[model samples]
Target: MRVVIIGAGLVGTSIAANLAADNDVIVVEDDPDRADQLQFDLDILSILGDGTSLATLQEAEVDDADMFIACTGDDRTNLVACGTAKTLGDPFTIARVKSAEYLRTWQRKHGAFGADHLVCSDLLTAENIVRVTGLPAAIDLDPFADGLVHMAEFEITADSPVASQTVAEADRFKSLTFAGLFRDGSVLIPGGETRIEAGDRAVVIGSPASVRGFSNDLNPSTTPDKADDIVIAGGSEIGYHTARLLEERESKSRLIERDETRARELAEELSGTVVMHQDATDVDFLSREHVDEADIVIATMPSDERNLLVAVLAKRLGVDRVIAVVNNDEYVTLFEEIGIDVAVNPRGVTAEEITRFSFESVAENLSVLENDQAEVLELELDSDSSMVGYTIRELDSELSGQFVVGALTRGGTLITPRGDTTLEAGDHVIIFVETSFADEIIARA
Candidate 1:
């Protein structure tokens, strides 16, 4: 695939890095230094010019692009670039915008910017926070197959039931499979004898009910005493989106904003939410409002430093979890080291989604787990597959260490593989493998 990306900032550069491994990528940046740095770091063609200009788009050869992405951190620039690219190439176009209103306008008017996809990093980041709110122990969680299937990651605690047990013995759930385990900085396709140890991150695939049970077992503290209360600092975009999503969960949520006008706007926009016009970092205001009782506190101030301080204060006020939306990637580790529960990078979140959509797959879906240590692929078997007529045992032998078949779907039914189960062509197969071996399975299945 030939991808032309119009930005060299964090999100665009990250997307380029992920795609350049298997695709021909061309990046255009007005800043010469960033473009040259990307060229030195990755095998990609770089154009040093303003991406919104027709000359720059022509110089980047938009006509040869299979996909054109505009993510220059400016909505006007991104929309103009996508419009220019679409006029020239008619390729699949994606524009990253900051405002939800612009995205709606694009969708309502047959793509107002000629962009096939509109990505709002703030909304994406907020949605990510909402997905994991009730999942305390989950390192990550993603759903597929119309919510029938789920891929989740859990960290093994020493006292957990699955911690000292082998893969075969960790059978708390009837409809779940341990897909892959990450330990000692290495990815492992666990077998029957692979013993799960403390600090190991285990990835699993299973039905929603089964995965939910396993998630609680992995982290017992997740079970809520009553309805969870949410306290959000700053009426930022992420704060508004998070509160809006938590409403569906029926949680009691509150938003604190220093600006009176924004507070009024948020109060009118969000129902069943308490909007407080005050400084969230102020101890007196937080104490007076009983912020300590919140189950989760999300810090979404404009600056990373302010968010970090808010998170620290929330923790000090007895909040169980503090999720910080950070702009600077370098501050992520620092936030974690200082005891923030979760540090989210809007760029990383958006980049992952864009990279996931950029793929051409024969499978139903592909989800990479644990920072690309492993990947879960949902594919269908065909007559050309090597394991078409083989039993589970034989198929396992054929796959060897490359991958593990996690589940099989025949017709509309799900099958947990046994040694004697025979796999036939046209059956749906879910396999989990080390990320390094994903392409091999993609080729065969």
Candidate 2:
């Protein structure tokens, strides 16, 4: 596949880096330093010019590109670049936009703005926040097989019942598979004898019921119920969408906006939300509002620093979980290091969404994990697949790739992968594999 990505920003760079290994990647950047740096860092070709300019697109050979991604930070620039790319070539165009309005417009009319697919950063981040809230103990959660299967990452806290148990002992859930473990920045493909430690991040794939049951088993006290309170600090676009999405789930949230006008607008727009026009940083106001007693507190402040502060404050106030929206990619680690339960990065979310399209025809879905060290992919097997009709254990021994079949969905039923489980055609298998072996595994399967 030939990919031409514009902007060379965090999102564009991430996509290019992920694709450069398996596909021909060309990046167009307005900044010479960024373009040159990308070229130096990756094997991708870099074109230093305006992406929206026809001459620059020509220089990048966009006409021959199989995929054209416009991921500039600015919405107009991304849309314009995608529109320009359409005129140059029939490549699949993807645009990253900050506005939900653009996504809605594109959804209403496919191919609008010349973008075949549109990723809305704020909406994606908000959806991410809601997914985390659904599983408070999960560091990350993604659905597969049309929501029939769920892949979740959970930190095995010191108090967790399964913290000191072996993988075999921890495999109590009927429809859940312990996919992998992350410890000390390394990915571990665990075996039955593998012991789960306190700080190990365990990745599991299973049915929704099984995942939720596992979450409750890990953190029963923090699991939210229908009556639990969710407080959202800030009235930014992400915050508003978060509240709205929560409302859609029949979870009413209290939204704090320092700006009175915005608060009134939100209150008027969101019938289920309680909009409070007050500073989220005000400790006295938080105490009076009982924010400390909330089950979940989300910090979606405009700035990363403010969101960090709000998250820290929420934690100090004894909130069960604190999720913060991190605008800058560099701040994600810092936010998590300082004890925020989850740091949702919009750019990262957008990048992941757009990158999935690269395997749209091959893998049904893909989720990057541990900074690209591993990936969880969902694939539907056909009769032509080499491993069809073979037991998972047999296939594991036959294939050289480092991967584990986490879960399989057949006829809308979740099947926890076991050694004796037989691979069948039309089965949607979700596998956790080393990123290096992802493409090869997909091809072989």
Per-model lDDT: 0.82, 0.90
TM-score of each: 0.91, 0.98
| Residue-wise C-alpha lDDT for candidate 1, range 1-445, written one tens digit per residue | 8899999998899789767867889999989899999999986899999988989899999999999999888998999999999878778999998888887798788677889999988898888888767565565677765566777777786778788899888867878888888888788878889999997888888886788888777666654543368888989988998899888778888999999999999999998899999999999889998999877888988889899999998888887678899898888879966878778888878877787777645667777665567778787788898768888777667664567777777876777767788888888877888876776777666
What is the per-residue lDDT of model 2 for residues 112-205, given as tens digits with 9 covering 90 to 100?
Answer: 9999989999999999999988888889999999999999999888889998999999888899899999999888999989999998999999
Clashing pairs in 1: none
lDDT of 2: 0.90
**What TM-score, to 2 decimals, does candidate 1 have?**
0.91
Q: Cα RMSD for candidate 1?
A: 2.6
RMSD of 2: 1.2
Residue 413, model 1: Cα distance from true site in angstroms = 3.5
